[model samples]
Target: MSTTTTEVLAFPNIKAIINDNGTAEVVVAGNSRVVPVGETLQDLRDNALALVVAEAKTLQRPVRVRIEDPEGHGELIVHPDGKVESVSYETRPARHRTAAPASTPAAAAVEASDSAAEDVAPADDEAAQQAVAADAPVTRRSLKETSFLVSAPVLEPATQGWRGALTRLGFRMNPSAEELSEREDIRTVSQHWPGPRTIAVVNRKGGANKTPTVVMLSAILARYSGAATVAWDNNESQGTLGWRTEKGAHDRSVLDLIDSSTELLSPSTNAAEIAKFVHHQTADKFDVLRSDENEEGDHEVTAEEVDIAHQVLTRYYRLVIMDSGNTARAANWRRMIDHTNQLVVPVTAIEDRAEAARLTLQTLESRGGHDAELARNAVVIVSESTDAKRSMTGDALKRAKAEAQRIADGFEPFVRSVVRIPYDPALVNGPIRYEALQPATQRAWLAAAAAVAKGF
Candidate 1:
């Protein structure tokens, strides 16, 4: 007989626990790291949860463990954010029945919400019928599973958002290695970010496509996730980021925000008031904060000023991509690096540009501090700096391509990832429109952006 039980859990880490004996001691682990058997039901749940959360780091994916006991059965669901949802139900004592194979991971879809159910692509009718035919009769225990799964079920790889659906329909038939890698990158980029994250695009070398990276990456993140993102210029003096982007009505720059940061930081300031200093790129759906472009305005940005401005930015944006000046030793530049959670180092096809990027990584490592650790996990982007309308397949082009690849390859051990961007005439000079780039160039930028997002 199937029985119903009720239990509560937050992203529970315990996948499955079997009641071994009447002693009431829950032996939930394989190693010496075991939870002490508790005196009461509440005590048992708390102790088991502590053990599961601690062991969670070793698991590949968050699991929903169906905990079976003599009196009842409980289910624990762990969400991507590591939050646990646990449900307990009562079960009647009966002989055990054979359970279904893993193919029916979605079998517990009864308890899922309408939105979550919609996220699962429809299963093949023929396959569904076959699975049903081969399955045993649903027991009372299965009913409880259904209720808990509907409430909060961890999506398995077989039912992974879009890719799995395509695979099931025979859409993704035969994919090349690059195609597969790019698909994985896209999935990684589109992940749910809980809060604001920062990416600093730097090389300490001008003309390395730093500004373009900041623009392209932030645009991709916002366009795909529908979240607010911003590109910030951390130039100590003057920078052309504002020049290459669409200008707003006001001449507000980073300094304007920094000067008024005291008011901006106040809890009373509304979002509209705080947004006055930011230049919104309407087409790309991301904002830009540039340094003063005036020749006479020679005021240098200090490290403390950058911090104050950053605090204000975090209040309004989900992601921040900073473009640095040519000089790496500036106070603002170092501060930007300090606050950066992910580092993106851009290089070009030119040997000097590529070498300069490599040297920047080396210098970071030489700093012998947290910067060294950050450099080791940086993403390197190699962009072709030419102004060619079509891909140039000349011998010189081939050689440069090979050299750039070689340069990127050398950093495989130290860096998180490296991607090469093809030359696009549209990107050579002028205001960058994300839609204006060639299809190939756009795809390359998407790949680069995905790589940077994954580093976070």
Candidate 2:
């Protein structure tokens, strides 16, 4: 024979409960519903409580409830198992307020009528409190039809009236990354501002995984330093930073400002105007200077234009990560390298790409023409794949050691540490937002960022 059980739960109002798996269902008052499979009686009760809290939070008010099941107060139960017997709920004080003060006779009459109504409201409030105290096993009876009222306390309009409630919901607040970045912009733009540091995550060979490294490093800097960092799509012909970030094509780009001729030239040339050219890629944190895929004009920016852009950028940013192209080096590349305090050359450990890394090291060593000092500051990174078929030990490592030795032979004392960055796909997609990243992935990115920041 089948069994049927009854339980009563007092909820101030009905709301849909969102389960752990993100599925939602509504539990209504005066209804007898069987708990679904995999959902315990306690689970259902906890869901009801969570739903109540959520509703209270949303309405910004206290909620009222009346029990309709089990025919009695203590007859209601949650965890029927001896492991845990029952659960209880009590209504909190309902918020109330008096009618506003009046000057006119009609208004006065209204206030007087409201004052009389307040006399009866206290009884209702007391009755609600008594209902809250009825958790003990006792007969439950239907009273004169009472309502589960969700009420917002009336407030005086003079002060920052509505703002108080909105503040509780964190209204008009930019996210943490964006808020901190704005402060960085202020500090960077202040008087006595020095030149900003621009580090180009470069590899001349295509498909070298350069873009992902730039994106990850930029995000890491934004999180750790709590500063606004700009990622420039300086890849000449085509770019992917904006596309990958999903910032849309209409986003204002640096190319829109300094294409070929007519550089904004000087620091006095409207800093605000220069700032207007930078698009906040998302809210405010990581800004971007994107690329126009079909920018047809043959107009090419001179070294002077690059210089002006850097000057304006420095005024409003502490760090700029440039994603440069593998094609012919733009005049901006030399100027950028000259201005940057550090140079990051990201390369994979593919046997086929080993010679390309060698040539890049040689190119860095050849800074005698434009600036020798810039070459001295460069850091080489050999990005090892976490899933690389070859081992990090034995002959695979022997080959890696050989590549390191080859670069060391050419650059000698200039080559800094050649750190190995394990391949992380999250770095390729977007910022390591909490919900978007695994705990392990976030830790790996942070560790890599710290390693690089410390000149490893």
Candidate 3:
């Protein structure tokens, strides 16, 4: 028979600090290292685990490490066989001590008896100390309230980029920092609120990318959240939202919806009935309610009609994104602002567009009520120049990028958030679809949507 003995190793202190800028500083035994791969809290933990596992392998023994992060403090045990286990401790609340009441004669007698017993049986000191500890006034919270549970399933590694390549070759490498950040953005936009929410996309200048912003935001939110979202064209007369989105078989518009608002708002109306006025984007998983596309129609959408259409849409869909016209003072546009829970201002990199966005915000602020509050909490999205094509020179593209950054910076102080979207020819024209967007463009839109979601 053969006998084997294994030794256990321990490291007393390992600290991981996760920063808001998607980086982590790890300290091990007074030595610190910055890990660039800590885009999420889970990433920070995995990086700490990898560091301890490597040391344990070299020492040929199981190791234990005390890990602390912003979330909580815990301990991790790494075995030489590459297995890891975690033990978490609950936090104890502060103990408040009040003056003890005068002890009764019986209590004094019991205490005297206990003191004599303790002195007589000195070998039971450890047990006596444990009893004292057990009676202490320490209130422990639940483990869930103090720290993350290690028993949760680990997420699979990346299947893209170099890590993905290694994964295909059976190397089992974790995802990169960029991939983890993207996943976090996706999770942010893929949330459901308590009730219906409306986002108004506005800019007083033509060619400010309002329509495309509405379409892309709706598409991203719908695709990621699986929620019923609608992009409504709130133009006074003729709007291009219908021209740039898919059309239904009957060519129904918001006018038709206003006409049937009574039936749609009724409790007996089925969810499918609202589809008659909406054009569903098959690939993007969202619906588009177009403006009055009839060339000969002389009627404009009035404020009352806007209210009716909005009530009907809100009854049917969980999210409604309104695409506004160039006029900020129009009745329908003002009504849209009244119904808005979140305000999004879209601007191209052009100077004129940027100025118009600033003016629009100022106009809203002058109203000095819900409009002013919306202006203060609005999110501004700056898109690069559409003219900078692949055939353009590097210098021109660089200039375009510089202009977009300038516009983004100008609005950052006034708005809650500012997101920059790169130029993509797919977004320049034609019916927009999420699947048709480039990978970089899609990621940019996803981030933009997440920023907007934060307002909710």
Candidate 4:
């Protein structure tokens, strides 16, 4: 649980002692705060943002930090923000391959026939191959976004609308302006993760836009990624993720999934059987796992229960976006965080919801250890509150932007990225149809979803 930061600490005048809880006592200029393992350096840069620039103005050498981790190491470039700006890699030596002797035409024909047969393997063989693929080492660097890219030939320059004009002339189809950004967004969301990667959208406050954020992100990934994605409401009692999502033929909840999971998890069960318990969204193309609706029932979703449900989910989904209840201390909530690979904290422009988001990040940092990494790399989304404001007046919009910026500034020191979601009356309340949102609002959610996808 300890992080050995500053392997060489002669300069930078900073020191961190990571506690077993996953946080470290980051000391700089006799000031210290308990922050996540990966955030100590960020805190240093935050407190010294102006000081560092001023020192350079006064002809001083700016401080720097070199960071290393279990997965390939990289330096912590001294940028005031502390987010990973760039990583330099030393290429691995080429494997020495013994060239195969020129095959006879008959032998080559035989090999080609075998390769063709391998493409249409049976379901059992496909599952076995996927299982083996899960064990392959992941070499992505830590504290960096995971983006899978698709390349295409470039003809006209993408800048100044040349690409768009060429497309009008029926020459090249390079996306530009909004289209270009959307294309890049699809690339980030299209990553083919070997195992399931879950994103927990959490805030201890009820009106922090957690469910909507989960729904939008799930929809975005499901629509563009060409893989199965599911949004599971892991609340102890009831949740709204399924309510807001498009209704399906079945009314089965997570409890039903848990009950059937034993048979569903068996190798003999139909691969499609898991769908019986999940509700499918039509336009979004993702599934939803509803929570237990009984208000007075003693059946609280437990950590072990979540684990079982999660196992069933991973078999069918590449990404699982979770909508959590307000109780941060609950077993289900903590379990969600434990299983999560990326943390996306959704908040509103309102004061209380913003505080709740901040407290959640602080709590995770104090709890420290593995959770620290989740906290440090968490993406914070600030949405304009859906209260009576009703998309605010001109001056009110200015104030809202200021408020969103203030919240973003507060979160900058702790999280990897802060995305401000603009106010859209369509998303004020009720069912969120991704296509129904205003174009601007859709773009905002797309940006937020893209940021979330990077952490996958």
Candidate 5:
């Protein structure tokens, strides 16, 4: 007498296409459904696994799945009992392409297999291999050609808000949605681009918060990304960025940097030598290239000087945030716009400031070419009035909020993004430090910086 081996039957294979926009298109037995999966490659993988496992349990059989994402392609075997076995996984050299949708032949084969599963006998190993070969695309790599190097699942422990409180009290909990969003914002600002980028902060009116916007963006980006960043006062004359930030060892200004641009730009020049002209913020982790502050001097920075200074700064720093003068028509201001990869207009929530910001963008749009493009993609930051007081009556506060909302709404259609910053006493006076900002204000700036980075 001979003993026979029992074969295990599996349901039709499932296909999952993971998209970069935080959603997955899951194909099951020729039917397609789009599911809102969480952001990140790991999220797509886990959610797809759960969906396939649920289908396997419904059929009371194992199921095979093929997953393609921006990262790479992989295959898995899911058992009805919630066990998952990785068959093959390979990561691409670079995350360049998203997975394409399931093809017609593959869908038809999947549908046929699903309909025949109940009536057909359990398939042997050889037959199962043949079925997979017929359903999978010919371009897919064979099992022997793929690697089985599996990455361990990463679980982020809650470290913020109520979820964090539960975690600290000996309970395991996932991060809240708010915390997850904050994490994504942090990730966005922390990324390093391929090359140096320039951002111009302009409003063409005095006291429009251009200086504050430049300082805050530079500080947030530098503090998060840990990259070299410089805030250059691109004013025609006597800009106040130096008065608002920490002082370095020397009293050097942009004039001094321009005088030595040739020496600094020399291939043999050391990177640290250029630091003599920039003032480092002790708390903000960024440098400030101050403008000429001489009370007796009447000299204005010219367009040619702006080019030379920009060249030197770009050579030394990965990011440059330029604070413009009140005159949008000035040669230096026009040149700064020419060099800007991202345009930011910061307006305090006042009628004149908002109007000035609008006019400034209109001026750029009128110039056409790259100026027009920059104006179209500019990020407008609307800040609440610094005069807002906690002691004010409820109606006064209500009017202030309504005005800010109105100003923000005005630019919503014309620009790429409009961010509102709350009134903070820390930003009103003295040297602006990232640590001095309120928690809410800091979060808002982080969001603003992420918006700026997306333009890069």
Candidate 6:
């Protein structure tokens, strides 16, 4: 067997060397790390290099490094080109366990002491297996979030560059644009809609399963339609969506935009800029615009700012998936709803008809919003079971199917289509690429996306 070895060396200024053959080689300070083909070398030495840089910041001496490959199994020397001098490696405790301790009553007792691991193993293993079941390589980047790139074959003369891109990407335009000022900049499509078609996914009562709906729908729209998607984390009070999506930072907050841009010029939020703030996961095929980590910004984005964002986006993205706050407490929620084409209401399969879906229906009915009439407009997804990540058997699966019909019937006059998304926690927790979804689940989302495109 060929063994692969890597060495970390320190140098003053490390730079990547692009050879004539297009191979990239790096020279570390005064040393080099050569990687033989067909071998994997982790960049652990990068950290050591960082440490050396930190030390050097205070005018400290560069760090030292040493590596060994007894059989020269896979030759990777620090100074393959003799640029780097010499270094030595010191014995240290290994980072991972070399072997398991011999089985003993004491050892067994210690291992068994914690019931948490044992108890959780079955559930976790099942989930892990399902998550890995897809034949695709389980790369971290595959799980990490990503943004979309909208492309158009031909830019329409009447359509603004962005609007043309958006229309081609499968989004519907709202009729409300007619009321906009004739004075408003009107071009082909841009002239038709002057305000940002901001969408707020609000359902104040938690457990509405709001976050997953936002994330998944956004992924679908961006992936299939090929449009830029942004999930505006408007849930100010304890932003849970960010936590669920693994983008727990304020770097891309609305506040960040508010802080950077002057009153005269709200920062031109472009695909690339928005992409930076977003957690891009090409595997998932979408971007997450995380909410404020601490305090919501003092200045809520005004309707005009929202319009400007829409206009700016008209030049870039076709669709904008804003994951608004669920609670009524979020002031921005109302603004978002005002601009939405369709109000998607996802309901879990509950026994009592009135208990789960009545409120959502009643709210829409009260607004007397056309959203209620567009039966095909309002999408209702009845989950087969509560926990989608796990398997449903016997009574559970049967009951789940039964409940879906019950829920659909309960909201009849109001709901146009009742789609079903099985309870797959992996869809919620792991990297959910378009190709990874169950065929049924994918169809439901696409149908929802199609409905959304109608109202775009």
Q: Give one digit per residue, the lDDT tens place, for model 6 in 1-456.
A: 221232333334444332222123334566664422211232333332333333333332333333332111111222221123333333344443222233644344334433334466765855544443442233243333332432212212223345445656676432122112111212211212333344445454556566777777777666555556666666543466666664533366555544443431445544355554557655665666566675644455455544444444334445566665554334456555655656667666664423545665566566665634533356666665454326777887777777777776766656665566666555655544566677667656665555455455
lDDT of 5 by residue, 393-413 (tens): 689988887899999999999
In candidate 3, which residue pairs clash?
A: none
lDDT of 2 by residue, 195-288 (tens): 4567777667766667766776777676556666787777665677776664643546665666421445554565355445655545325667
Preferred candidate (TM-score higher): 3 or 4: 3
- Kindly report which residue pairs in candidate 2 clash with one another: 12-64, 74-137
C-alpha local distance difference test of each model: 0.73, 0.52, 0.83, 0.73, 0.85, 0.49
Ten consecutive residues with minimal summed lDDT in candidate 1?
A: 146-155
The candidate that wins on lDDT is 5
Clashes of 5: 0
Q: What TM-score do all the candidates reach, one by one?
A: 0.64, 0.46, 0.73, 0.65, 0.73, 0.49
Q: In model 4, which residue pairs have backbone atoms overlapping below 3 Å?
A: 21-368, 21-369, 22-368, 22-369, 23-368
Candidate 5 has an lDDT of 0.85
Ranking by lDDT: 5, 3, 4, 1, 2, 6
Number of backbone clashes in candidate 1? 19
Alpha carbon lDDT at 310, candidate 2: 69
TM-score of predicted model 4? 0.65
Model 3 residue 53 distance off true place after TM-score fit, in angstroms: 15
lDDT score of residue 379 within candidate 4: 97
Off by over 4 Å in 1: 1-183, 387-393
Q: How many angstroms is residue 363 displaced in model 5 relative to the true structure, after the best TM-score fit?
A: 0.8
| Better structure of 4 and 6 per lDDT | 4
